[model samples]
Target: MASAVKVLLIDDASLIRRLLGRVLNQDPLIEVVGEAENGQEGVELARTLQPQVIILDIEMPVMNGMEALPLLKKAAPKARIIMFSTLTESGARATLDALSAGADDYVTKPSNTGSFAATAGQINKQLAPMIKALAASATTYPSIRPHAEPKAAQQTVPDADHSWLTVTSDGAPEIVVVGVSTGGPQALQTFVPALPADLEVPVLIVQHMPAMFTRLLAERLDAQSAVKVGEATNGQVVKPGEVWFAPGGEHMYVTRQGENIVLTTDTAPPVNECRPAVDPLFESAVENFGSRVLGVMLTGMGNDGLAGSRLIKSVDGYVIVQDQASSVVWGMPGMVAKADLADQILPLNEIAPRVVDLLSTPRNRK
Candidate 1:
């Protein structure tokens, strides 16, 4: 039998603790080994118990999640820390700060206390799966490679595996579409900075995040990157040298407007259970750029990009995916690779260069 994953719940609210415990204990694979009402106690328990995972609340008494994050890591290096944050502007900022401080991933707490059953369902549907996956990664440490270049990629990576996909067609890539989740914040921290300042292709990204979180993520990435980055606005012109992000709670797409490519956003129904799904952006790229789109599927859960990549492949558009070793959860990329659709399977470090290399390939299609 698979051993239960030991989890420590650290939240300031007793109600939240009790509710979360109720939801988590129901899962046979997860065992709530301990509980703490503040960060200081959480840190102490972490050092002593050394559980496989920690669901850390960002806002807590005695010591908030952000302040206690580094210290907790020092105490329990092996425990994967998942931040619990409210769906607010300040909460989003704290969540990003926690990620910078080395927290593994984050999950949004219930918006309000008005709904219990629905909130519990969210915990079950979202938080439980996240805990299970993180614990699995902790048990199976091979998902992280210790020797990867650039500091951010050194954690949670597998052995390097790649293949340069080839296609026989004449197409000029005008834009790059990126999709990532799970380890996305850290992954983008490195990958975006690696991109050349004079990058010719306009980059659009969809990172599974909430409304304010996407804006904060863009700001963080832009601060470190040579290429300018920002949240995508409705009907903005898609130009070179800047990376645009699909704002959370909306779907972003691009259309050719005479001499310019115009970007647009919509609150369309969630696709593949995600507000800003990769398929729509990838499909939009096909509509405007045809076989010249470069679709990149990064570390994320589920198969959001499979259908999009299939469409891209059918039109001879190139698709590059993050290798398993470099992914926190290789679900998105793995799905495309399983279908034999990816043209290049690369580590995070190699993806930007490969994009630059492909951009330099002269269009000679007949």
Candidate 2:
């Protein structure tokens, strides 16, 4: 018989430990080998159990998940860690920190405890496939080496004289659309916080994640950015100096009504194997905003945004892709570059400034 996947659950709450343990134990393929109520204890248990997976809670009293992650990885390099975080702004920031520190995946702690009985069912449906895939891929794929910080590129804009000051009626873009996955949290942390506070356009983002993660991501972004960032709600008017992110398990698209653009969400068929896929957002931009859209594809693990970039190009919308050397996985943006869908391929460090420069230019009129 095949050996079961051993799991270690670590959280401060006894209720959560019992609940998650009950839920995870239901899976014939997964066995809960151990449990820890704090990060320090979790680290010790991890060394002892040598589990195939560790479910780590971000907020712990003894040692936080972020701090424990590297130590845990050092102790058991082969163990896959799945961070469990609350659906809050602080929780999102901590979760992203854990990911950067080496957590393999994450899940949100459900707010409704009454729904605890169904937790395992939901987690298995969403995470089991990813875990299995990671396990299978690990045998063939070498572990990721730490990537160096990317150096910024210095490229002179064509219309350098007019780049900073020119804002013509024809060149003023109304919306900025962004798409990312995989290494997005880190990328977003670097990108979104750097955007100019006085930016004249509204930004729409679709980061491939679960529903709970997206909400937390938006809240975290909102706290970090001068511009308002929040989960996209149906019929909400798109406004400048604000950002609306695609909700998880749903597709977000833009629609124009009179002079205003409104955000809409739906249970649309999954595109590119993601409900909040980048293709629909880009496709919708082409149909709704036409030449006024600026589409950006960033670091991710798949070609989810490639077709979308092509669609943006079809309608004369400007498309920018993050260069392969700067991407964590180079799957999404690399696809756009390979297909020649991008107007320019830039490093992550240069992408935001280039965007600001492009939108600031008068010659690239809509």
Candidate 3:
């Protein structure tokens, strides 16, 4: 028989420890090797148990998940750490901070005490497959290199000679479509907040996330962006200076009504194994807007957006992909680059400015 995946559970509450243990133990592929009621103890147990995975709670006593994460990494560098956080503003902020601090992923805790069955179902549904995939990929070998930057320009517009913002079309884009996953939360935190408040086009976003997490993510982005960011509702109007996120477990598509666009949500089967898949959103944007569309694929895992990018290119629409060096997993954007679908591939830090420049160009107005 195959060996089980060794897991270590860390949390401050006894009830959480018991509940998590019960839930995880139900999986024949997973075996709980150790447990801790605090971050300091969790770190020590992680060092000793050397489990394959660690489910960490951020609100633990003694060290807290953020403070203990680096130490745990040092002690067991190969073990993947998944933070368990509450579904609140503070929890969202802390979870993002944990990711920046090197946690692999996160899951939300159950809101009510009696919701163990539902929470366990969600956890198993979301994480088990991801963990299995990560385990399989962990054995692969590849060394990554640092990205080379273009030489500085003499004028205010840096690298103007090699700038990727050239307009190839003769009209204003009719739609703006964005794709993101994996380390998208951090990327969005940096890029979306920088967009101009008076942006004159409708924007649609597809970010890979679970249902409850998307709501929290939308709330966080709305708090930061000049644009009104919110979870996409069925049949909502897509307007200027407002950004709509594809709700988890549903695909978001665009349809036109006169000169305006209407956002639609559907429960169609998962595409590319993701419900709010980037491909559907991208393809829908192409169908609805044709040559007057801008497709941007950001940092993410897997090849979810490449096919859609090709569709956009076939219609003479513009495509921009995040460069590999700035990506967390480099799967989605790398696929676009490898397929030669991207008009330009840029670093994460440069993407927002590049977008602004693209939109603000005189040629963009046709």
Task: Provide the global lDDT of candidate 2 against the true structure.
Answer: 0.75
Give a tens-digit lDDT track for model 1, residues 75-169.
99988899999888898898988887788899998866557788789998899988888777533323332222211111111231212223334
| Per-residue alpha-carbon lDDT of candidate 3 for residues 228-293, written as tens digits (9 for 90 to 100) | 999999999978888889997799999888876899999999999898999888877867776678
Give lDDT per model, in order.
0.82, 0.75, 0.77
Model 2 CA lDDT for position 333: 75
Once model 1 is optimally superposed onto the true structure by TM-score, how far is the C-alpha of residue 307 displaced, in angstroms? 1.2
Candidate 2 ranges with C-alpha deviation above 4 Å? 1-64, 73-81, 85-104, 108-172, 362-366
Candidate 2: C-alpha RMSD to true structure equals 8.8
lDDT of 2 at 70: 89
* Residue pairs of candidate 2 with colliding backbone atoms: none
Clashing pairs in 3: 174-292
- Highest-scoring model, TM-score: 1
**Model 2: ten consecutive residues of lowest lDDT:** 149-158
Assess candidate 2 and give its TM-score to the true structure: 0.67
